[model samples]
Structures are given as C-alpha cells and as structure tokens.
Target: MKLILIRHGESEANFANYWTGWLDVDLTEKGVQQAREAGRRIKKANLAIDCAYESMLKRSIKTAQLVLEEAEASFVPEFKTWRLNERHYGALVGKNKTEMTQQFGKEQVQKWRRGFDEVPPLAKENYFDRRYDGFDRRLLPKGESLRMTSERVLTLWQDQIVPRLKSGQTVLVCGHGNSLRALIQYLEQIPVDKVDEIDVPNATPILYTFDSLLRIERRIEL
Candidate 1:
C-alpha cells in the first residue's frame, strides 16, 4: 500500500510569522498556489490516491480537496478528525513568532517549538468553537507538547489509519506541520530528541510504500 503525507500550504499566520495553534485561519494566494503545485507534482508521480484524511481546520481540508482534485482522484473517501489538528500553542496563539523569540530568547522558544515534552504556557480560558461541542471539555488542550500531540494523533492512527492500510488502501494525509511531525516521528521511529532536526515544508509531499504487513518498504518526496 502507498501512504502520502503533506503539510498544509502556508497560512496567513505563516506569512505574518505568527503562532496560530487552534486558530481558524485561511491560506494566502501564495499558499493556494503551493497546494496546487503539490497536486501537480503528485499527478506527475502517477500515484492514485484511494483515501484521504485531514484535520478539521480548513487549511488542511482545502489542501486535501485540491490535491485529490489535481491528482484526478476527487472521488476518494476523505476523513477529518479533531485529533489531527495542529498542536495548541495556548497563550502563544496570535503572537508573532519572531517577537516571541526575541523576548523569550531563541533557546526557550526553540524548546517550546520542537522539544518533545516542552509544553507552551497554558491559555487562561477555553476558546474552542462549536465544532468541538460534542467532545468533553476537559479533554481539550490548553497547550500541547509534541508528546501530548502524539498521544492523541497516534490514537487515530492506530484506530483508523492502520485499518485502511491493512486493507490495501492507498492513503493520503494532509495535515499541519507539528501534527504531521508527530505522525512522522511514529512512522519512521525517529528518536524523540532527534525530531528537532526534522522540518516539514509547506505543501511538499512525502510518499511511503509499505509491505503487506504495513512495514515501510521505501520513502520518497514527491
């Protein structure tokens, strides 16, 4: 089976160098173009996507739609889940990233951004929208370290993704940078400390071919 992973294209937050965890934001025109180009690249690779997954965020949802449309696989089943959403930045939400780096010092901000267990400062209130209404409020994140993101994300991976892959379905996961990183950390079994060195660029696609047992046979960037 083939599995493809792609981070959502640049958002307005990215353009402004801001932290936008759990903030609903739209993509810029450049971001839209980036997503389209990603689709074209996948089309060139001739990989037929059978099923797709995305986070609840529109940025991720739209990217998956565009990719499947571009790859001529628009009819594929698409799934969206809250667990696949971006890591919550808590009090860091809407703050400028560069300024945070300047104020907090590079080392500290880096820890919050990339460290496995370093959670950002918690938000004072729960600002989740109606979309999250059915979920238990206590389960919502105030802020999340990579470890926390992994715990929730991997639950969906184990429960939902593994089943389809085992059924011989080709899957496409379009997600945010940190969420995708958590998934990648699990898939590749990368050392947690070493994960800081990994960076997922916007709209770029990574393809993994798997054996019948779902073991990774090979990986390639499309």
Candidate 2:
C-alpha cells in the first residue's frame, strides 16, 4: 500500500510569520502554485491516488482540491475531518512567532513549539465555529501538546486510514505541519524526545510504501 502525506501550502498566516493554530486562512498566491507543483510531482511519479484526506480548514481543503484537479484525479474520494486540523496553539494563535520568541525567550518558545508534553497557554474561550457545530464540544481543544495532538490523529489513522491501507489502497493526506508531524512520528516510531527534530515543510509530499503488515518499506520526499 502507498500513502502520501502533504502539508498544506503556505497560508497568509505563514507568510506573515504568525502562529496559525486552528485559524482558518486562505493560501497565498505562491501557496497555490506550490499546491499545483505538488500535484504535478505526484502525477510525474505515476502514483495512483485512490482517495484523499484533508483537515477541515480551507487551506488544507483547497490544497486537496487543487492537487486533485492538477493530477486529473478529481474523481477520487475525498474526506475532510476536524481530527486532522493543526495542533491548537491556544492564545498564541495570532501571535507573531518572532515577537513571541523575543518576549518569552527563544528557549521557552521552542519548548512550547516542539516539546512533546509542554502545551502552550490555553485560549480565553473554547472555539465556537459553526463548521464544528456537529462535533462534540468537549472534543475541541483550547491548547494541545504534540502528544495530545498525536493521540487524536492516531485514533483517526487507526480507525479510518489503517483499514484502507491494510486493504491495499493508496491514500493521500493533505494536512497541517503539526498534525502531519504527529502522524509521521507514529508511523516512523520516532522517540518522544526526538520528535522535536522532525519538521514538515509546506506543500511537500512524503510518500510511503508499506508492506502487507503496514510496516514502511520505503519513504521518499517529493
């Protein structure tokens, strides 16, 4: 089975150097081009994607749409789930990363950003977005550590993605940096402390070929 994981293209927040968290933002022009390039790369690799999955955010949703269109695989099944959204940054959502680092000290910011269990400060209130109306309110997080993000993401992978891969299906996942990192950590069996070293770049696809038992046979970046 084959699995392709792509982080969503750069968002306006990313271009502005702000912490995006769960905020909904559109792709910049360069981000759109990057998404197209990613699709073309997938096509050039001759990988047939059976289905695609993305987070509920528009940036991820748009990337998936653009990828399918560019790959001429628009007919493929697409799944969007909140479970794949970026790790909630809580009160830091709109803060500038550089300014935050200067104010809080680089080490402290690094701990909040990459530490396995160090969750950032909670948001003032729980999110009340209409898009998440149907989901359980308690499931929404005000803040999350990488470990917490991994738990929810792994649940979705085990329940939704693993079965498909086990049946020999090829899947494409367009998601955010932290969420994808969480998934990669699980798939690659990276140590908790070592996960801090993993960084998923924007609009790049990480392709994985799996054996019958779902062990990774090979991993390639495109």
Candidate 3:
C-alpha cells in the first residue's frame, strides 16, 4: 500500500504570519504553483494514485483540485472531511505569531504552538459556519492540542483511509500543517515530546510504502 501526504500551499494568513486555524482562506499564486509542482512530482515518480482526501477548508480543497488537474488524475475519487482541518487555534486565530510571542512570552507561545497536550485559550463563542452545518456541534472544537488533533485524524485514518490502503489503493491526502503533522506522528510513531521537532513544509509530498502487514517499507519525500 502507498500513502502520499501533502500540506496545503501557503495561504493569505500564512503570508501575513498569523494563525489561521479553521479560517477559510484561498491560496496565493505561489501556492497554486506549488500544488501543481507537487502533482508533477507525483507523476514523475510514476505513482498511480487511486484516491485523494482533503479537509473542508478551501485552501486544502483547492490544492487537491490543482494537484489532481496537474497530475491528470481528476477521475480519482476525492473525499473531504473536517477531521483533516488544521488544529483550532481558538482566540489565537488571526493573531500574529510574533506578536503573540511578545504578548505571552516566547516560551508560553511555543508551548501552545508545539506542545502535544498544551491547548491554547478557547474561543469566546462558537463559530456558526454553514460549512459545518451537518456535523455535530459537539464535534466542533474551540481549541485543540496537537494530541486532540491526532485523535480525530487517527479516526479518519482507521475508518476510511486504512481500508482503502488495505485494498491496494494509492491514497493522496492534501491537508494543513498541523493535521498532516498529526498523521505523520501516527505513521512514524514519533513520541509525544518529540513531535515538536517534526515540520511539514507547505505543498510538499511525503510518500510512504507499507507492507502487507502495514509495516512501513520506505518513506520518501518529493
């Protein structure tokens, strides 16, 4: 089985250096190019993608579309779910990371950003977005630690992605940084404290090949 994971390209908030958790934002021009490049890379590697997955957010969805178009794999089935969205930053959404560091000390902000169990402050009110109308309100979180993000993503992997892989399908996942990180953590079995060291660059693909028993045979980056 093969799994390919790509983080969505740069967003407006990314350009502005702000936290954009759960915010719907479009990709920048360079981001579009990056997505296309990722697809081209996949083609060059001669990997036959059978299915794709993405988050509900526009940036991820758009990246998946662009990638499929460039790869000429639009016929592949693509699934979108909120479970792949970025970790909710709560009140920190839209706040500049550097400014937040100044406001709450560098160490504190670092913990909130990278610590597996360190959840930030919750949002004052729940956002009533129509994109999530059909989902259970309880499933929507105001804030989440990396551990929390991993739990939800793991559910999707176990229930949806793993079965597809077991059927000998090559799956592509276009998602956000934190969400992709969560998946990587599971794939690599990285320790909780060590997860902080893992960084998923935007629009880059991480390819994994698994044996019949689901043990990793190889990991490649493209």
**Worst ten-residue run, lDDT, model 1?**
126-135
User: TM-score, each model?
Assistant: 0.97, 0.98, 0.98
Which pairs of residues collide in candidate 2?
none
TM-score of 2: 0.98
Candidate 2 residues lying further than 4 Å off, grouped into runs, are: none
Ordered list by TM-score, greatest first? 3, 2, 1
lDDT of 1 by residue, 78-128 (tens): 998889899998899999989999999999999999999999999999777
Q: In candidate 3, what are the lDDT values of residues 12-73, reduced to their tens digit?
A: 88898999999998999999999999999999999889999999999999999898888889
How much lDDT does candidate 1 score? Answer: 0.92
